[model samples]
Target: MLNDTVSPDFFRKDAAFDELYPEHIRELSQMHWTPIDIARKASDFLAVPNARVLDIGSGVGKFCITAGFYHPETAFYGIEQRGELFSFAEIAKEEVNLSNVAFIHGNLTELRFDDYDHFYFYNPFYENIEPDSRIDYTIRTSFGLYDHYSRLIYQMLDEKPSDTRLVTFHGPDKQVPPSYRLVNNSSYSRVLKMWIKE
Candidate 1:
């Protein structure tokens, strides 16, 4: 059984946090889940007080849970298309006891962009283009879906009001609209970028 009283330092390492999920889910961490440190840094940039941050494809709720744990004032929401992943996210959220985090099981295109104030994306569409990166077989993957989702996100980000924050980890820069200016990023890599709409 897992510990009920999660420590304050639980955020220190990925293994400590990954304990929330089962072995199979934990195995996917190296590729799928956001590294604990990256999630912390990205959340720091995006979690303006009372902001609603949406993780475009919140796989098993790792990022959302981490962000919500660190930024208690900000609410984090993740939309996942896979029911299996969504179920795990909900279970993990309960174990963590974070009221500020939520999980939605639905397609990204079905959501209203206006519902969220900020965005976090981890190349959710990559699996569509890269055959080996898919999380599961529930969602159809194709170059066409990649193009469609990319175009849809580009246009959506383009329409957001000024100062809308966005953080993308290992994401395609082209998916971001020219209106969203890259402001800050890690010194080691451009893989993680922080952006704001002008």
Candidate 2:
């Protein structure tokens, strides 16, 4: 059980935070989930007071839960295509007791871009192109689906108003539109990048 205060100690390390989930879910942490530190850095750039941040292909809510826990004033929403992952995300959010985090069980294409003020993506569409990196066999993945999803997200981001924020972790740079300028990036690695629409 977690402590009542939910101190920062609980999030000090990825292994410590992975304890919130079951054993199998914990196993996927190294691959499918975002590290706590990366989540924090991404949230720092995306979180604006009262802003709604959406995590595309949020796999077990790791990004959303971490962001919501750190930034209570911001609402973090995650849309996951897998039902099982969505259930686990909801459970994790409940366990963490974060009111600002929400997990939606649906595809990214179904979401309305206008509903969110910012976005975070961790190469969600890569699984469609790389079979070895697939989270599971439950969802159909193909090169065609990857192209379609990538195109859709590009269009969505392109349609958003100026000043919309975006963070991409290990995602393809081509997916981001020219209108959104790269504002900053993690010095540790180029895998994490922050962008703002001009």
Candidate 3:
């Protein structure tokens, strides 16, 4: 069980955790990083003992680390396409001293969806076509790449067995396969959606 006191306030108070990155990266948290509250809630829902959970397009490992710490019984893995972000995630994981969280530097396409039982996604592909919300110019973002990734994820999720759990944050419902049915939603409405396969 996770300690309720290990909340956002607790993490934020730790200077090391809050200062994991430089000024620019820190500034991006409000827009890109998953909030601690959301991470805890999602982890609680998807964390089956010894189950594997994947964070699609995990930017800097914020979600993975927070969730892993709260739910130690479940292993959390993150796949990031950007090398720089992947590096930062590794360093932060070391600082936090967590062992269940791991990050891979590669595109989401390379991941084997069968390896994971549950998933957490934070609109990992939005930057591909949304010009205003682009994370950086380091990555190649185009409508074609966005469509490809979406289709890949949709198909992979479609193949998963029934009762597979998934949580999407600030993502379009269309990206999810129709086989998955909505289980519940946060009071925040569209921002956080929980689903389970039929």
Alpha-carbon TM-score of each model against the true structure: 0.94, 0.95, 0.92
Give RMSD (Å) of candidate 1 vs. truth. 3.2
- Candidate 1 lDDT score at position 98: 79
Candidate RMSDs in order: 3.2, 2.6, 2.5
lDDT tens digits by residue: candidate 3, 1-198: 763434344365333454877777777787888887788778878898999999999888989988888887899999999898899999888877777899999998887888999999899888888888987789899999999999999999999999899999999999999899997757755688899999
The regions of model 3 sitting more than 4 angstroms off are: 3-16
TM-score leaderboard ranking:
2, 1, 3
Greater TM-score among 1 and 3 belongs to 1
Candidates arranged by lDDT, highest first? 1, 2, 3
Residue 169 error for model 2, in Å? 0.3
Better candidate by TM-score, 2 or 3: 2
Model 2, 1-198: lDDT tens digits are: 222345665588999888988998899999889999999999989989899999999889999988888888899999999999999999888888888899899988888778999999999999888999988889899999999999999999999999999999998899999999998858745899999999
Among these predictions, the greatest TM-score belongs to 2
RMSD of 3: 2.5
Give lDDT per model, in order: 0.90, 0.89, 0.86
Off by over 4 Å in 2: 1-5
- TM-score for model 1? 0.94
